[model samples]
Target: MLARVRSTNLAVPRPDPGAGRTTGIDKRPVDRIEVFRPGPRYGDGPGVVGDHVGDTRHHGGEQKAVYAFSREELDWWEGELGRGLPDGMYGENLTTEGLDLESLLVNQRVRVGDEVVLEVSVPRTPCATFQRHMGERAWVRRFTERGRCGTYLRVAVPGTVRPGDPLEVLEPPAHDVDLRTAFAAAMGDDRAARSVVDAGCLPTIYHERLARHLAGEG
Candidate 1:
């Protein structure tokens, strides 16, 4: 089956007393969104024009311009949590289908619709805000252990994206550092961390973290 966007979502303002004054974790489906490369998280917010990104310190930037989660993974979460996980429940901008996000290698490129091209940059890391959003006990731990964290994309070619847009996943990169491995590395797996560092092509922040990990500093 061809990969496709099941839904496009934009943030809905909600109070988050923990980190940012407000949270954009509650995203609702939208008809369409214009994708672009927002330079950095501190100033340039979400790539999807008009989407809210309350926590700029860690989210939304050129490397994390877009976040995508697959329906298959959501289904698995639904079964695990014994609750319905609607599209965008995980704060992803695009709810995709027919894609094994975990298997996608870092730097892999995907064409959305007819114009926009996104490069897989990194895997989403679970934070306190995410745990609070899910309202599940030990949500972070569960998510980390699963190692099915969604993929964050960099807008290589900007354009409009809408529901049902066909996703054309391009060929894999030379390295074999898939999202699963990356996620594991982020969660402190020594071997996975080495693999990610060896693969290279990661964002600078990740490189720094990997370096620290290798040096027994992280």
Candidate 2:
């Protein structure tokens, strides 16, 4: 199977009754999207133009400019949950096919179609918003245990991306810290956390978290 984008998704606002907040977790497929580096999570918004990001505190920014998930993983979840999980159901901007997202190293670059270049930055951490979105009991714990958290990307080269665009993964960085290891780190694996910190390719948040964890403050 060739690596390509099965769909491009944009946020669809939904009311989070649990938290009394609006969430953009309900994403739906779109024909096309403009991709760019949206500087900081606080001031700037989603890297995909016209996309809505309700929770700026935790999501959106240069490091999380885009989110990509594999269709294979979605299929696995569909069977596990006994329901049809469509493309973009997991709030990913790009529903990709035939890519091992977990194997992608931090700082690895991939070109989408002919234009956009994105760098693998981090793994999508399951959070309260995601749990509420799924509405499954202990969804966060289940997702974390599964450890197929998908990948978050930072826009390196701005351009337009559309459905069916081919994905060209560039050479990986020297570090061996892949998304799986990073996800494990996020899940409190001290060894994995140390590996990610040693890689030194990810955003500062990971470093700070590791520091807090070591200090027994996290």
Candidate 3:
């Protein structure tokens, strides 16, 4: 994998990537997301607040997109990226400053918007494309084990959201049932596997797969 880092102006994130900085991605918190297509709920502006992500192929809801992270993860990213993680550099939507991504446990409850609560599901495991982008040596699988990678979320209940909005954790995870645990349990007892997946709030396909595995069909 090639570490395609541009010059400081291009590579590094913008305007104080500090954890508390809410202006840009680098400063944002967990439960993070950027609206490529701000839908109906999102008002028109440069980085409007209380906006909706819009519709997708699978899930349907007024509030479309969501993101998450912790203060520690942002700091960690700064260390990993070797500077401020500039916006629009690596295609990362939400910067998630100071949130030690490695510590973001599975099944963690990441409240995106005020009323839009979402649970952290599976880590964003790097595919070949990611390998090409980051290096193959980037240790993509480590993210899965550490639960450092961000998870895709489906809206449980719709709510209005905006950039710079504070992300809250309505419910914290009960013990760290990270991806490692999930994979392990999945390979072990069927019911345990199913339980772990359900508890993690994984994507529907994963949840269904676990259910099937529990039924002894897989």
lDDT of 3 by residue, 1-218 (tens): 21111111111233322322222222222233333333323232212233221212321222223333333443556686566544332324343442343344565655554555555545444443334344436545644344444433334554544445545545566665664455445444454476666674555666777777777788
The clash tally of candidate 1 reads 0
lDDT of candidate 2 at residue 95, scale 0 to 100: 95
lDDT by residue for model 2 over 1-218, one digit each (tens)? 99999999999998888878788888999899899989866447889998988887888888888999999999999999999999999999999999999999989999999998999988998989899888899999999999999998999999999999999999979988989999999888998888877777677876787867866887
Of candidates 3 and 1, the better by TM-score: 1
Clashing pairs in 1: none
Q: On residues 4-46, what C-alpha lDDT tens digit does candidate 1 reach at each position? A: 9999999998999887488888999999989998886545787
lDDT of every predicted structure (CA atoms): 0.90, 0.89, 0.42
Error of 1 at 128 (Å): 0.6
Off by over 4 Å in 3: 1-71, 74-84, 87-92, 97-109, 112-115, 136-138, 142-146, 157-160, 172-204, 208-218
Ranking by TM-score: 1, 2, 3
Worst 10-residue lDDT window, candidate 2: 37-46
Backbone clashes, candidate 2? 0
lDDT of 2: 0.89
Q: Could you give me the TM-score of model 3 versus the true structure?
A: 0.47
How many clashes does the backbone of model 3 have?
33
